[model samples]
Target: MNLSVVIPAYRSERWVGRAIRSALAEGVADRNVIVVEDGVLDGTAQVVQATGARLTSLQRNGGAPHARNLGLAQVDTDYVMFLDADDYVENGLLAGLVGALERERADVAIGPWVYDGDGRERGMLRQPPALDNAERIFHWVMHAFFPPCCIAWRADAIRAIGGWDERLRKDQDGELVIRALIRDLKVAVSEQGNGVYWQHDSPHRVTKAQIKDVMYAADVVFAQLEGWVRSRIANGSAGDERVSLGRFCCKTAWVAYAYGDSAAGAKWSAKARELGFHNRGYNYRSALLASVLGIRISSRIKASTRLVYRRIAQR
Candidate 1:
């Protein structure tokens, strides 16, 4: 196998097969598609088999990276990439990505990632401000860097870094790439275009449920990322790690509140407030970031925040 394309399937029965087929069919190269079902409620394994793609099953749900590494370790592909079971790849995506990797002889190949709904583009995960001739991947972590799905990596390079850490539920991709950069790995960027990242938004669109879960994950991830920043500062890298850590803290704060953990979330909100992130609607993102920093939103501030809250209550 020259390429291993791993899809971590979790409750993705609606389109797990489609995601697999897209990997096998539209990819520009000969790569094996492995769909790892994480103890799903639906017949996700059956769906993978039905598509004639290889299937791997875990006895329980262990999040994305865990499912990915199971399939990843079994293959001998020269390169590896990941895709969420719910996401579908686009035409020319695989070929364009592979060509760039080969041309640059890069340990990893990256590109712009556009976020989309089932049929339309919703947003995009921006490439870093820059990937300088001499760059620091750790500095430009994309929520979690080198988006796992939008990237392809030399298999040996994957091993050299010991593969994805199964511990991370949210920012594993970013964590992995930064580790690679610390080892001074060479990464390539493609000029083909942004690869589509299909986001399965809620039909309700603005329910408490939708935003709540998002906050839960963000809260957890930011805590881990803070530790990562501290370790970096200890190593004497660049300016203050506080700036980055503070930014993540504020973002996690609002999500924590959205997810119904207002008490826990309030802590993040207050920390963000203390950090001086007081921009209006931007405060929504701020509230969540503050939550991660672990401080409480004063009852007085919470009461005041309610007046503006009604204007956007439905969403």
Candidate 2:
């Protein structure tokens, strides 16, 4: 097979048909577009079957990482790309991605991602066509390299690095891409890609713990990163930059709020003061959280805090 498009679907009967049709319309001859149905109640497997794409239903919903891993095991193609069942590619996606990979002779090819809702593009994360491994890492600092639907990668590169970390609730894509980069995997960015990432996530989505902290992946990743920092301090790990500890108390505070532990959130926000992250964004979020909880902090105190936030914003 020339290319494999792996779509891990769960409860996506409403959109799976369109997603499969989009891939078939792309006209990649001998292409394998495999949709793994993860215990979907909405007949998502039947939808893919009707679209003429092969379907493999999982016994249960095993999260994104598990579905991707299953897809990887099944693909026989030289190159592979992941696509969520709810998202579809716009016109010219197949030609752009496949051609870009062939021309660049890269181990992995990525492209720009556009967030769409009800047939309208709302947000786009654009990327340069060509980049080195180091540049790819920095580029990822801004946005994810693989939009799941935007990457065409050599099968060997994925297998060698052992694929993704299934343990993470979110940011599994980033972790996989980072592992590929750290191993010096050759990669390229597509010149054009109209892949649409449908926005179905809400303010309170499921997290690693499946409770609060819908965006809890960052904090867990941070803890792991701290370990890297410590090992490096002891002069361990020859390569790998010591896990970048720029003091993200701002992010820590948000993580706290997401986990539904207001006290923990407040503690992190207060610590942000000591860490010099007493900024407008974090402060505003803190106040919002405080407001929702009906905290006893009065209006005058809120005003003072807001002023302090503005001062930090200036910096």
Candidate 3:
């Protein structure tokens, strides 16, 4: 199958070459490697041009979604895959994903990915079995899956859903895939690991520094999900599937507290309570403390506990 790979790059001169090389190594021709440079001329454009990949340089930084949409508009192949500039896919990843899609006649095919950085394997993000229904896909989204790098899509299928949400600065992949699943498209999952997502701890990375933007995106995603669930319930198509809004809210609350946004944390925890989510797991203690002492005080207590534990350990 003819496949086109899109890599959205910004200040990625250091690793964008490797990403392009990885795609080319998968037997994808140079003409099919499209790199959308998001207005950062940090020598990334030079590297991409040197590799002979088709380069589309935007006038200014428009974030990943914009770059991806721009790249999507340029796709002319049967299948398409996205690779972040800092990450590289394993050999044959494109062929593996395309083969799975063709064999299953699926609109999308996904494979497992490993999270690694600084020359060490951190862990794996495994794709669940083939999801055929909206409810199952919704459940998967509530848990925050990895990025879109692990999947390949039938180019037309993605266009049918209007591509990614350009307004979202984060969680764009989850939002896009969730809409596709809600539209009742078929999905095939390959258990074979094929992708690598580099985890960067640098504060410059959006994932590391954009907590507020991420939380805002989360709210939009969950709101859409809640609407979908309501629609499913109204149509009587929701089977044994339960909407895990409470769990989602609790998780969001924890994230807010961890990011030092106590007001947001308390608000989300209250929302979870309203949704009938009983904090029954590791969140139980923190939930209770946040409820009684407010998230700010509760967070302080937790921080002190961690500090004390570390001091004791060093003794």
TM-score of each: 0.68, 0.71, 0.86
Could you report the Cα RMSD, in angstroms, for every candidate shown?
Answer: 6.4, 7.4, 4.0
Which sequence of candidate numbers ranks them by lDDT, best first?
A: 3, 2, 1
Put down candidate 3 lDDT per residue, 1-315, tens digits, no spaces: 489999999888888999999889888889899999998668998999999999998879998989998999999999999889988887567788888888989898888777777635467566556546664564665544756678899999999988988888777777788777777778887776578888654554556547788788878877776777678779998653332767777777766776788788878878777777766222568768867886567766786787685455444
Residue pairs in steric clash, candidate 3? Answer: none
In each prediction, how many residue pairs overlap at the backbone (N, C-alpha, C within less than 3 A)? Answer: 23, 1, 0
- Highest TM-score: which candidate? 3
lDDT of every predicted structure (CA atoms):
0.63, 0.64, 0.78
TM-score of 1: 0.68
lDDT for model 2, on a 0 to 1 scale? 0.64
Is 1 or 2 the stronger prediction by TM-score?
2
Candidate 2, which ten residues in sequence have the lowest lDDT sum?
238-247
Tens digits of lDDT, candidate 1, 123-143: 655563446422443255324
